[model samples]
Target: MRDLIKDAIADLKKGDGFIYVTADGSKIDLHDAASKGIAVTPVNPKNQVIKKLEAAGLHLNDGKFLNELNELISLVTGNGVTSKTSKRRTFSDAEKSKIVEEWKKVEAAGKKTKAAFAREIGVGYQTFINWLRG
Candidate 1:
Protein backbone atom coordinates (compact mmCIF):
# COMPACT_ATOMS: atom_id res chain seq x y z
CA MET A 1 0.00 0.00 0.00
CA ARG A 2 2.90 2.32 0.77
CA ASP A 3 4.29 1.65 -2.67
CA LEU A 4 0.95 2.70 -4.17
CA ILE A 5 0.91 5.88 -2.08
CA LYS A 6 4.49 6.73 -3.09
CA ASP A 7 3.69 6.15 -6.73
CA ALA A 8 0.69 8.47 -6.38
CA ILE A 9 2.90 11.11 -4.76
CA ALA A 10 5.40 10.83 -7.57
CA ASP A 11 2.65 11.19 -10.12
CA LEU A 12 1.20 14.16 -8.29
CA LYS A 13 4.62 15.83 -8.09
CA LYS A 14 4.90 15.45 -11.85
CA GLY A 15 1.84 17.75 -12.18
CA ASP A 16 -0.56 14.90 -12.83
CA GLY A 17 -4.13 15.16 -11.58
CA PHE A 18 -5.36 11.96 -10.10
CA ILE A 19 -8.51 10.52 -11.69
CA TYR A 20 -10.88 8.63 -9.44
CA VAL A 21 -14.06 6.80 -10.49
CA THR A 22 -16.94 6.96 -8.06
CA ALA A 23 -19.17 3.94 -7.47
CA ASP A 24 -21.87 5.62 -9.53
CA GLY A 25 -19.55 6.10 -12.52
CA SER A 26 -18.89 9.74 -11.73
CA LYS A 27 -15.37 11.27 -11.78
CA ILE A 28 -13.69 12.88 -8.77
CA ASP A 29 -11.53 16.03 -8.94
CA LEU A 30 -8.14 15.53 -7.21
CA HIS A 31 -6.00 18.34 -8.50
CA ASP A 32 -2.41 18.38 -7.18
CA ALA A 33 0.05 16.96 -4.66
CA ALA A 34 0.88 20.37 -3.25
CA SER A 35 -2.82 20.97 -2.62
CA LYS A 36 -2.85 17.65 -0.75
CA GLY A 37 0.26 18.68 1.30
CA ILE A 38 2.52 15.90 0.02
CA ALA A 39 5.63 17.81 -1.03
CA VAL A 40 6.61 17.29 -4.65
CA THR A 41 8.59 20.34 -5.75
CA PRO A 42 10.68 19.24 -8.79
CA VAL A 43 8.52 16.05 -8.52
CA ASN A 44 11.34 13.53 -8.36
CA PRO A 45 10.91 10.01 -7.02
CA LYS A 46 13.12 9.05 -4.06
CA ASN A 47 14.08 5.37 -3.83
CA GLN A 48 14.95 5.51 -0.11
CA VAL A 49 11.72 7.34 0.71
CA ILE A 50 9.67 4.78 -1.18
CA LYS A 51 11.53 1.92 0.55
CA LYS A 52 10.63 3.29 3.98
CA LEU A 53 6.92 3.52 3.18
CA GLU A 54 6.92 0.11 1.47
CA ALA A 55 8.53 -1.47 4.53
CA ALA A 56 5.78 0.07 6.67
CA GLY A 57 3.06 -1.49 4.45
CA LEU A 58 1.30 1.75 3.53
CA HIS A 59 -0.42 1.60 0.18
CA LEU A 60 -3.20 3.38 -1.74
CA ASN A 61 -4.91 2.35 -4.94
CA ASP A 62 -4.36 4.11 -8.26
CA GLY A 63 -6.57 7.20 -8.83
CA LYS A 64 -8.10 7.09 -5.33
CA PHE A 65 -7.20 10.77 -4.78
CA LEU A 66 -6.27 12.65 -1.60
CA ASN A 67 -9.23 11.51 0.47
CA GLU A 68 -6.64 9.14 1.89
CA LEU A 69 -3.77 11.61 1.89
CA ASN A 70 -4.06 12.33 5.61
CA GLU A 71 -3.99 8.61 6.34
CA LEU A 72 -0.89 8.08 4.20
CA ILE A 73 0.81 11.08 5.74
CA SER A 74 0.07 9.73 9.21
CA LEU A 75 1.58 6.39 8.25
CA VAL A 76 4.72 8.03 6.88
CA THR A 77 5.08 10.57 9.70
CA GLY A 78 4.26 8.07 12.51
CA ASN A 79 1.02 9.81 13.62
CA GLY A 80 -1.79 7.70 12.21
CA VAL A 81 -5.35 8.95 11.72
CA THR A 82 -7.78 8.42 14.59
CA SER A 83 -11.52 7.82 14.51
CA LYS A 84 -14.29 6.24 16.51
CA THR A 85 -15.37 2.64 15.87
CA SER A 86 -18.86 1.22 15.81
CA LYS A 87 -20.39 -2.23 15.83
CA ARG A 88 -22.85 -3.52 13.23
CA ARG A 89 -25.09 -6.58 13.28
CA THR A 90 -25.55 -9.02 10.43
CA PHE A 91 -28.85 -10.82 9.75
CA SER A 92 -29.03 -14.19 11.47
CA ASP A 93 -29.75 -17.46 9.65
CA ALA A 94 -33.24 -17.48 11.10
CA GLU A 95 -33.90 -13.99 9.79
CA LYS A 96 -32.69 -14.92 6.30
CA SER A 97 -34.84 -18.06 6.32
CA LYS A 98 -37.84 -16.03 7.41
CA ILE A 99 -37.45 -13.53 4.60
CA VAL A 100 -37.10 -16.33 2.03
CA GLU A 101 -40.11 -18.08 3.46
CA GLU A 102 -42.11 -14.89 3.31
CA TRP A 103 -41.05 -14.38 -0.29
CA LYS A 104 -42.20 -17.92 -1.09
CA LYS A 105 -45.55 -17.38 0.55
CA VAL A 106 -45.96 -14.11 -1.23
CA GLU A 107 -45.28 -15.87 -4.50
CA ALA A 108 -47.52 -18.85 -3.72
CA ALA A 109 -50.49 -16.66 -2.88
CA GLY A 110 -50.99 -16.17 -6.66
CA LYS A 111 -52.76 -12.82 -6.30
CA LYS A 112 -49.70 -11.26 -4.53
CA THR A 113 -51.61 -8.31 -3.08
CA LYS A 114 -49.46 -5.85 -1.17
CA ALA A 115 -51.86 -5.79 1.80
CA ALA A 116 -52.12 -9.54 2.02
CA PHE A 117 -48.35 -10.13 1.83
CA ALA A 118 -47.69 -7.40 4.39
CA ARG A 119 -50.30 -8.92 6.75
CA GLU A 120 -48.76 -12.38 6.29
CA ILE A 121 -45.30 -11.03 7.24
CA GLY A 122 -46.63 -8.74 10.02
CA VAL A 123 -45.02 -5.62 8.46
CA GLY A 124 -46.49 -2.45 6.99
CA TYR A 125 -47.88 -2.92 3.48
CA GLN A 126 -45.83 -0.09 2.02
CA THR A 127 -42.64 -1.44 3.64
CA PHE A 128 -43.24 -4.94 2.30
CA ILE A 129 -43.97 -3.61 -1.18
CA ASN A 130 -40.83 -1.47 -1.17
CA TRP A 131 -38.74 -4.39 0.00
CA LEU A 132 -40.10 -6.50 -2.83
CA ARG A 133 -39.05 -3.89 -5.41
CA GLY A 134 -35.71 -3.25 -3.78
Candidate 2:
Protein backbone atom coordinates (compact mmCIF):
# COMPACT_ATOMS: atom_id res chain seq x y z
CA MET A 1 0.00 0.00 0.00
CA ARG A 2 2.64 2.53 1.04
CA ASP A 3 5.76 1.49 -0.83
CA LEU A 4 3.68 1.04 -3.97
CA ILE A 5 4.22 4.56 -5.30
CA LYS A 6 7.97 4.74 -4.69
CA ASP A 7 8.38 1.25 -6.08
CA ALA A 8 6.32 2.43 -9.04
CA ILE A 9 8.53 5.50 -9.39
CA ALA A 10 11.60 3.32 -9.32
CA ASP A 11 9.95 1.01 -11.82
CA LEU A 12 9.01 3.93 -14.02
CA LYS A 13 12.52 5.37 -13.87
CA LYS A 14 13.87 2.01 -14.97
CA GLY A 15 11.51 2.35 -17.94
CA ASP A 16 12.24 -1.13 -19.19
CA GLY A 17 8.72 -1.04 -20.66
CA PHE A 18 7.41 -4.31 -19.38
CA ILE A 19 5.00 -5.28 -16.64
CA TYR A 20 5.31 -8.72 -15.13
CA VAL A 21 3.02 -11.00 -13.15
CA THR A 22 2.63 -9.84 -9.52
CA ALA A 23 0.56 -12.77 -8.18
CA ASP A 24 3.73 -14.76 -7.36
CA GLY A 25 5.54 -11.65 -6.05
CA SER A 26 8.69 -12.66 -7.85
CA LYS A 27 10.76 -10.86 -10.51
CA ILE A 28 8.21 -8.07 -10.94
CA ASP A 29 7.11 -4.86 -9.19
CA LEU A 30 3.51 -3.61 -8.94
CA HIS A 31 3.89 -0.81 -11.41
CA ASP A 32 5.62 -3.29 -13.61
CA ALA A 33 2.25 -4.98 -14.05
CA ALA A 34 0.38 -1.70 -14.56
CA SER A 35 -1.57 -3.46 -17.37
CA LYS A 36 -4.65 -1.22 -17.13
CA GLY A 37 -5.16 -0.08 -13.54
CA ILE A 38 -1.66 1.40 -13.48
CA ALA A 39 -1.71 0.00 -9.99
CA VAL A 40 0.27 -2.52 -8.05
CA THR A 41 -2.73 -2.40 -5.71
CA PRO A 42 -1.99 -5.77 -4.19
CA VAL A 43 1.41 -5.77 -2.56
CA ASN A 44 1.68 -4.27 0.94
CA PRO A 45 5.44 -4.75 0.78
CA LYS A 46 6.29 -2.51 3.78
CA ASN A 47 8.06 0.08 1.63
CA GLN A 48 9.33 3.05 3.71
CA VAL A 49 7.83 5.45 1.21
CA ILE A 50 4.43 3.80 1.70
CA LYS A 51 4.82 4.21 5.44
CA LYS A 52 5.66 7.87 4.93
CA LEU A 53 2.66 8.30 2.71
CA GLU A 54 0.52 6.85 5.48
CA ALA A 55 2.06 9.10 8.12
CA ALA A 56 1.49 12.24 6.05
CA GLY A 57 -2.05 11.20 5.24
CA LEU A 58 -4.40 13.81 3.81
CA HIS A 59 -7.44 12.42 5.71
CA LEU A 60 -9.70 13.47 2.83
CA ASN A 61 -9.02 10.91 0.11
CA ASP A 62 -10.91 8.03 1.78
CA GLY A 63 -8.04 5.57 1.13
CA LYS A 64 -6.28 6.36 -2.15
CA PHE A 65 -3.20 8.53 -1.71
CA LEU A 66 -0.67 10.20 -3.96
CA ASN A 67 -1.27 13.42 -5.82
CA GLU A 68 1.44 12.01 -8.06
CA LEU A 69 -0.75 9.10 -9.07
CA ASN A 70 -2.01 10.79 -12.23
CA GLU A 71 1.48 11.48 -13.53
CA LEU A 72 2.49 7.94 -12.61
CA ILE A 73 -0.53 6.47 -14.39
CA SER A 74 0.30 8.31 -17.58
CA LEU A 75 3.89 7.13 -17.47
CA VAL A 76 2.95 3.54 -16.78
CA THR A 77 -0.01 3.22 -19.11
CA GLY A 78 0.38 6.16 -21.49
CA ASN A 79 -0.41 5.30 -25.10
CA GLY A 80 1.15 1.87 -24.71
CA VAL A 81 -1.70 0.53 -22.62
CA THR A 82 -3.41 -2.48 -24.20
CA SER A 83 -6.95 -1.29 -23.66
CA LYS A 84 -8.71 1.77 -24.99
CA THR A 85 -10.43 4.50 -22.99
CA SER A 86 -14.17 5.12 -23.40
CA LYS A 87 -14.01 7.92 -25.94
CA ARG A 88 -13.68 7.24 -29.66
CA ARG A 89 -11.11 9.22 -31.63
CA THR A 90 -12.20 10.10 -35.13
CA PHE A 91 -9.57 10.19 -37.87
CA SER A 92 -9.95 11.78 -41.28
CA ASP A 93 -10.12 9.56 -44.38
CA ALA A 94 -6.79 10.95 -45.57
CA GLU A 95 -5.23 10.13 -42.24
CA LYS A 96 -6.53 6.58 -42.48
CA SER A 97 -5.11 6.19 -45.98
CA LYS A 98 -1.76 7.55 -44.86
CA ILE A 99 -1.59 5.12 -41.95
CA VAL A 100 -2.46 2.16 -44.15
CA GLU A 101 0.17 3.17 -46.69
CA GLU A 102 2.87 3.47 -44.02
CA TRP A 103 1.91 0.08 -42.65
CA LYS A 104 2.55 -1.35 -46.11
CA LYS A 105 6.21 -0.34 -45.82
CA VAL A 106 6.43 -1.74 -42.29
CA GLU A 107 4.84 -4.99 -43.40
CA ALA A 108 7.19 -5.26 -46.34
CA ALA A 109 10.19 -4.70 -44.09
CA GLY A 110 8.92 -7.53 -41.87
CA LYS A 111 10.51 -5.92 -38.85
CA LYS A 112 7.27 -5.22 -36.96
CA THR A 113 3.68 -6.38 -36.56
CA LYS A 114 0.45 -4.58 -37.23
CA ALA A 115 -0.30 -4.52 -33.51
CA ALA A 116 3.06 -2.94 -32.70
CA PHE A 117 2.68 -0.33 -35.39
CA ALA A 118 -0.84 0.47 -34.24
CA ARG A 119 0.46 1.04 -30.75
CA GLU A 120 3.20 3.32 -32.06
CA ILE A 121 0.62 5.43 -33.86
CA GLY A 122 -1.57 5.47 -30.74
CA VAL A 123 -4.40 3.53 -32.34
CA GLY A 124 -5.87 0.15 -31.43
CA TYR A 125 -5.11 -2.93 -33.56
CA GLN A 126 -8.74 -3.34 -34.56
CA THR A 127 -8.95 0.30 -35.61
CA PHE A 128 -5.79 -0.04 -37.65
CA ILE A 129 -7.07 -3.25 -39.23
CA ASN A 130 -10.35 -1.57 -40.11
CA TRP A 131 -8.45 1.06 -42.03
CA LEU A 132 -6.93 -1.70 -44.15
CA ARG A 133 -10.31 -3.38 -44.64
CA GLY A 134 -11.12 -1.51 -47.82
Candidate 3:
Protein backbone atom coordinates (compact mmCIF):
# COMPACT_ATOMS: atom_id res chain seq x y z
CA MET A 1 0.00 0.00 0.00
CA ARG A 2 1.17 3.53 -0.78
CA ASP A 3 0.11 4.54 2.70
CA LEU A 4 2.38 1.92 4.18
CA ILE A 5 5.30 3.15 2.08
CA LYS A 6 4.64 6.70 3.09
CA ASP A 7 4.33 5.70 6.72
CA ALA A 8 7.58 3.77 6.57
CA ILE A 9 9.36 6.70 4.97
CA ALA A 10 7.92 9.09 7.52
CA ASP A 11 9.16 6.80 10.26
CA LEU A 12 12.60 6.94 8.70
CA LYS A 13 12.39 10.71 8.71
CA LYS A 14 11.54 10.52 12.41
CA GLY A 15 15.21 9.46 12.88
CA ASP A 16 15.54 6.86 15.67
CA GLY A 17 13.01 4.37 14.18
CA PHE A 18 11.69 3.04 17.49
CA ILE A 19 8.12 2.90 16.26
CA TYR A 20 6.82 -0.11 14.37
CA VAL A 21 3.31 -0.67 13.03
CA THR A 22 1.93 -4.17 12.96
CA ALA A 23 -1.00 -5.75 11.09
CA ASP A 24 -3.27 -5.78 14.10
CA GLY A 25 -3.27 -1.97 14.03
CA SER A 26 -0.96 -1.98 17.01
CA LYS A 27 1.93 0.42 17.14
CA ILE A 28 5.03 -0.74 18.94
CA ASP A 29 7.66 1.41 20.58
CA LEU A 30 10.55 -0.97 20.10
CA HIS A 31 12.96 0.49 22.65
CA ASP A 32 10.19 0.56 25.25
CA ALA A 33 9.20 -3.04 24.52
CA ALA A 34 12.74 -4.32 24.68
CA SER A 35 13.40 -2.37 27.83
CA LYS A 36 10.35 -3.84 29.55
CA GLY A 37 10.92 -7.39 28.38
CA ILE A 38 13.61 -9.82 29.52
CA ALA A 39 14.35 -10.79 25.93
CA VAL A 40 12.92 -10.29 22.50
CA THR A 41 12.89 -12.33 19.37
CA PRO A 42 11.96 -10.73 16.10
CA VAL A 43 8.45 -11.75 15.11
CA ASN A 44 8.04 -13.08 11.59
CA PRO A 45 6.27 -10.31 9.69
CA LYS A 46 4.88 -12.42 6.85
CA ASN A 47 1.34 -13.05 8.16
CA GLN A 48 1.08 -9.66 9.78
CA VAL A 49 2.33 -7.92 6.71
CA ILE A 50 -0.16 -9.77 4.54
CA LYS A 51 -2.94 -8.87 6.92
CA LYS A 52 -2.00 -5.22 6.65
CA LEU A 53 -1.89 -5.46 2.90
CA GLU A 54 -5.33 -7.04 2.83
CA ALA A 55 -6.69 -4.35 5.08
CA ALA A 56 -5.29 -1.82 2.65
CA GLY A 57 -7.12 -3.57 -0.23
CA LEU A 58 -4.26 -5.64 -1.59
CA HIS A 59 -4.52 -9.42 -1.52
CA LEU A 60 -2.09 -12.32 -1.91
CA ASN A 61 -3.86 -13.87 -4.91
CA ASP A 62 -5.08 -10.96 -6.95
CA GLY A 63 -2.63 -8.21 -7.95
CA LYS A 64 -0.46 -7.73 -4.88
CA PHE A 65 3.10 -6.68 -4.05
CA LEU A 66 3.77 -9.09 -1.21
CA ASN A 67 7.55 -9.33 -1.54
CA GLU A 68 7.98 -5.60 -2.10
CA LEU A 69 5.80 -4.78 0.91
CA ASN A 70 7.75 -7.20 3.11
CA GLU A 71 11.01 -5.66 1.98
CA LEU A 72 9.82 -2.15 2.78
CA ILE A 73 8.62 -3.27 6.22
CA SER A 74 11.94 -4.94 6.92
CA LEU A 75 13.83 -1.80 5.98
CA VAL A 76 11.58 0.44 8.05
CA THR A 77 11.90 -1.82 11.13
CA GLY A 78 15.65 -2.49 10.58
CA ASN A 79 14.77 -6.17 10.69
CA GLY A 80 16.01 -7.13 7.25
CA VAL A 81 18.11 -10.26 6.97
CA THR A 82 21.70 -9.43 7.83
CA SER A 83 23.27 -12.82 7.14
CA LYS A 84 24.25 -14.24 3.80
CA THR A 85 23.86 -17.88 2.88
CA SER A 86 26.92 -20.15 2.89
CA LYS A 87 26.03 -21.57 -0.51
CA ARG A 88 25.70 -19.52 -3.67
CA ARG A 89 23.04 -20.10 -6.30
CA THR A 90 24.09 -21.87 -9.46
CA PHE A 91 22.22 -22.83 -12.66
CA SER A 92 23.16 -25.58 -15.12
CA ASP A 93 24.15 -25.03 -18.78
CA ALA A 94 20.72 -26.15 -19.95
CA GLU A 95 19.04 -23.65 -17.62
CA LYS A 96 21.29 -20.86 -18.84
CA SER A 97 20.50 -21.65 -22.46
CA LYS A 98 16.78 -21.75 -21.70
CA ILE A 99 16.87 -18.34 -19.99
CA VAL A 100 18.88 -16.89 -22.88
CA GLU A 101 16.36 -18.24 -25.34
CA GLU A 102 13.49 -16.62 -23.48
CA TRP A 103 15.44 -13.33 -23.30
CA LYS A 104 16.00 -13.44 -27.03
CA LYS A 105 12.34 -14.08 -27.65
CA VAL A 106 11.42 -11.13 -25.46
CA GLU A 107 13.99 -8.93 -27.20
CA ALA A 108 12.67 -9.93 -30.59
CA ALA A 109 9.26 -8.77 -29.42
CA GLY A 110 10.87 -5.37 -28.45
CA LYS A 111 9.57 -5.60 -24.92
CA LYS A 112 12.44 -5.21 -22.47
CA THR A 113 16.22 -4.93 -22.05
CA LYS A 114 18.45 -7.52 -20.46
CA ALA A 115 18.19 -5.72 -17.12
CA ALA A 116 14.40 -5.52 -17.32
CA PHE A 117 14.19 -9.15 -18.37
CA ALA A 118 16.58 -10.10 -15.60
CA ARG A 119 14.42 -8.35 -13.03
CA GLU A 120 11.34 -10.02 -14.47
CA ILE A 121 12.98 -13.42 -14.04
CA GLY A 122 14.50 -12.52 -10.64
CA VAL A 123 18.16 -12.81 -11.66
CA GLY A 124 21.04 -10.34 -11.72
CA TYR A 125 21.47 -8.35 -14.93
CA GLN A 126 25.10 -9.41 -15.27
CA THR A 127 24.13 -13.05 -14.85
CA PHE A 128 21.47 -12.71 -17.56
CA ILE A 129 24.03 -11.11 -19.87
CA ASN A 130 26.43 -13.97 -19.22
CA TRP A 131 23.69 -16.38 -20.18
CA LEU A 132 22.99 -14.38 -23.34
CA ARG A 133 26.68 -14.31 -24.26
CA GLY A 134 26.78 -18.09 -24.36
lDDT of each: 0.51, 0.60, 0.63
Q: Count the backbone clashes (under 3 Å) in each candidate.
A: 4, 3, 0
The residue pairs found clashing in candidate 2 are 2-50, 3-50, 19-32
For the record, the alpha-carbon RMSD of candidate 3 to the native fold, in angstroms, is 16.0
Residue range 1-134, candidate 2, lDDT tens digits = 55655664665455445444444445456554564454333433334334544566622222123324444576788843433343467999998999899899879989788887887676888888888996
Give a tens-digit lDDT track for model 1, residues 57-122. 543221133235555676789875544332333555577467657677657867666575555444
Winner of 1 and 2 under lDDT: 2
Off by over 4 Å in 3: 1-87
Candidate 3 lDDT over residue span 52-119, tens digit each: 65687666533125456566687789985633332356888898888888777778999777776776
Q: Which scores better on lDDT, 2 or 3?
A: 3
Candidate 1 lands at a TM-score of 0.24
| Candidate 1 worst ten-residue window by lDDT | 58-67
Question: Quick one: how many clashes does candidate 2 have?
Answer: 3
TM-score of each: 0.24, 0.36, 0.38
Error of 3 at 114 (Å): 1.0
Q: Against the true structure, candidate 1 has what lDDT?
A: 0.51
Model 1: which residue pairs collide? Answer: 1-58, 1-59, 2-58, 2-59
